[model samples]
Target: MTLLALKNISLRFGGPPLLDGVNFAIERGERVCLLGRNGEGKSTLMRIVTGQQQADDGDVMRSQGLRIAEMPQDVPKGLSGTVREVIASGGGKVGAALAEYHHLLHENPDDLDRLGSLQQILDTQNGWALDARIDALVAKLDLPADTDFNALSGGLKRRALLGRALALEPELLLLDEPTNHLDLDSIAWIENFLADWDGALLFITHDRSFLRRLATRIAELDRGQLTSWPGDYDNYLRRREERLHAEAQEVALFDKKLAQEEAWIRKGIEARRTRDMGRVKRLYEMREQYAQRRNLQGTAQFTVQDAERSGKLVAEAKNLSYAAGGKTIARNFSTTVLRGDKIGIIGPNGVGKTTLLRLLLGQLHADSGEVRTGSNLEIAWFDQLRSTLDERKTVWENIAGGKEYVELGGARKHVMSYLQEFLFTPDRARSPTHVLSGGERSRLLLAQLFSQPANLLVLDEPTNDLDVETLDLLEELIVDFAGTVLVVSHDRAFLNNVVMRTLAFEGDGRIGEYIGGYDDWLRQRPVATARPAAGTKPKPAAVPVVATAPASKSPLDSKQKRELAELPGKIEKLEAEQEALGLKLATLYASDPGKAVETQKALSAIEQTLATAYARWESLESLRDA
Candidate 1:
């Protein structure tokens, strides 16, 4: 069933429309991920959907009895209650009204009929079971039961808010950048939770892996229009690449056609000259047509210069440790940086990844060990704060400040040309730094970083505000960079694509160096009861067995006897129930539209059961028999 629908939606912020004639419908149990570059009205659209903002021209139709719970990027103030109280308050006004009604009922039972009616209403709404649901949500969000909401850290507070949002159990959930402040483990937990969630979810996030695992469809908001793709994030990316390639090919064909027409027009004009005015007019018209056709092709170019190399050992940290508020953020961390090494530093929140970067750059002093720098090591540090750029200065000045020669390739080149490479147009390059969006600022910083030659690059959360296109450009630059790099980023996709090595800082002040990309590190890391098989003895159960007296009856034959005996029963029972549930779900979708909201829940339960049965069946079927 359609849970929410927006028709001809138009929103404006005193100027141009942020969203123009946008039409979209979200169905029950559908997990749709919204993608767009920063400052492209993604957050504004979310606000409109949640009723916090009204569209200038459009209609928002929500299904009757549908409840929407939104988790905004910024946490609102006035929530001064304890964590438990805040979580329990997700029932909203209903919970408050029920509590007051219950108190009155307990005090005066003389009006038994009225009190009983109120009790029935509360019971029907499951008001009494809300606490249990809240507890479960809190546990799932990894929040401590006794922690106070007011005293929680930013990350913890965000998790608490998420818990409250989930506890509401609304028919539709709107989340904006839910994975931004979360660690890897928390992100994984959220992915799993959303995978199992029954209600419809519409979220905006840059985490590619999260989108790939959770999203069933992708809604991309670009140039004030929303387009839907019928696949996960990865599939959407693949399809987008093909679309771009097709667009490029079409533009090329148009250019070739225009050139041919122009050549014909030029010949016609030259041959006719002063003899025929009609021929001249026809040639001019043809030129105009070619000009119009040429305008159809978009003009934007991104190019990075080849980086100049420096000597080896760009920077080195030996037993680096930092203390803040009488607690060690990192301890005994050591890593060497080669001339061409692209190292990524990642860890949970508050794990001192940034601190380690600061230590390497000598911005922060280590409590224990020393930092060594190579000869002629010129470092270009892109701090997460981005405090280097003066907000009051225009983009032009920010880019060209203190530089002797701002021209590149003698095209009257200024900061504008450099900014253009990062997708900032000439007009935008003249805008004040304070007026730029987060993504624009990030690109500007990158442009500035690349303007001058540097042997070493230290970037902290460089991908934080960058769009996918800009990130792609940055990745290409990093791959081609001849300088050493030490990057601190939570972006798994970026790290995997750009970095060759990883320096993982675990929360307990221990850092581990892993060769290869993020995926390789994950594969080598300990997961559940499974550890990396590095010089370890195999368990007795895992060891292979050989029978000495198996001349008449082979060992393989004996094992096969046990497997065939168990295979049929396992397959029969699982297949029977799987078919039943599949039919039941199909019927539900066909009959009651409201049942669509519960489909994901039912499907998850079915999947769990089927997976278990399938695993057992595979194990039984794999054994050899006599």
Candidate 2:
């Protein structure tokens, strides 16, 4: 069943029409993902669906009594109360009774007279079912029901708002950037929850993994037009490319014919003949068509400015331990980052990912041990909090610093032209930083960071509000960059595609080093029992009990046996390479110092590879004995 439709919709805000003769519809079980660039009219169209805004022209059709709820991009400003009370407010008058009853029963249990009155209201209104549903939702979202909504973190606050949206029991739900600040575990949980949701969903998100897992269809808003593709995200990519290619061809042919007509009409006396009037009229129509055509926006192009090469040992930590606010952040953690190494740091919220980066950069003092940074290491830090940006300053002033020109690739370019390369118009460049959207601010940061030269890039949550196209381009730039990168991100696909290794925080200040990305860590990490909750007593150690091995135990397979036999030889070769590199490093430092960094990088690689081989060999031997 079609829940809602937009027919011949047209909306404009001063300039061009954001939505021109748009037509769209959503069915009962559809999961539609909206893809668009920043500042497009996606949010406006959503408001139109909810009746919060009216289109300047056209009709919005909805089914009789259709229910719609939106989980807004920014949390509502005036929400105040416990989590339960906030969610209950979604149910209207009956929910008000439940909220009051809930408050009285918990906070004023001794006041039975008031509680009795509230209970009677609930009974008469059939509000008990709504109360029960609120209970289930609170537990499912793992929200602190009795806690003040204003006290929760950003991610938790978003979850509470989502609970309220779900409480509405709407036939259609709209979500905007649902995974913005969530950790990996929370994102996974929400993905699972929404996959099982029965209602139709229309959401805007830049998370490719989430879109791939949820979207049954893809919809794009481009240059005042809405287009829908009937398949997954990958399918849309393939088909959109074909569509654009064909469009280019058609436009080229039309322009050629128009040019030929212009030449014929330019023949003054010959074209003034009566028979030529029809051809002249057709030329005028072609000009109108050409004037109305809307072109596609160009992709953002940027490159990092390179500085002088740094020493081979970018940074090293030994027995490093740090603590803040009486909580352990890192305990006896150690790692070596050589030049050209790209490392990704990931953990739950407030789990010290940024702290680790600071510790490595010598920006903060460690509680114990030490960090050693190499020589000539120029660092450019992309702060997640956007503290580097001055909200009071205009975009051009923030980036240009009173200069009319900036240097790019050894050439001086005007500030306006530089900003334009990032898709920022002159008017937008003059706008204050506070007025820019999340995506625009990110772009501004990139423009600022790339204008200067550096050898070490430290990015903290840099992927938060960027569009998918920019994210892909950023990933490519990082992969091709000559400098070392230490990025802290929650984007799984970005991590998988960009980083060489990962540093994951396992609980209790323990940081584990894995050879690859998020999925690689999952495969190699050992299965362990859940830890006890805070303030819980430790369980007594269990007495060991011996058991006999099963008689039907299978021997190692042929492939496993072959891998086991080859491990020793690989380990030996790596050790020999490690020794040679070490000796060469010493000789180069004394004789040809410029070549020492390359030798040192090779030595570090061999050491890590050798460690992996040793671990594999031990595992194989244990399996053989079993």
Query: Which prediction has the highest lDDT against the true structure?
Result: 2
Candidate 2 displacement at residue 247 in angstroms = 1.2
- Candidate 1 at residue 355, lDDT? 76
Worst 10 residues of 1 by lDDT: 294-303
Give a tens-digit lDDT track for model 1, residues 484-544. Answer: 8888877788889999999886556777888877787787655442332322244556566
Q: Which candidate is the best by TM-score?
A: 2
Q: What is the total number of backbone clashes in candidate 2?
A: 0
- The per-model lDDT (C-alpha) reads 0.72, 0.86
Where is model 2 more than 4 Å wrong at Cα?
A: 104-117, 268-275, 529-626
Query: Candidate 2 at residue 301, lDDT?
Result: 91
Query: By TM-score, how accurate is candidate 2?
Result: 0.82
Which RMSD values do the candidates have, in order?
9.1, 15.2
TM-score of each: 0.72, 0.82
Tell how far residue 379 is off in model 2, in angstroms.
1.6
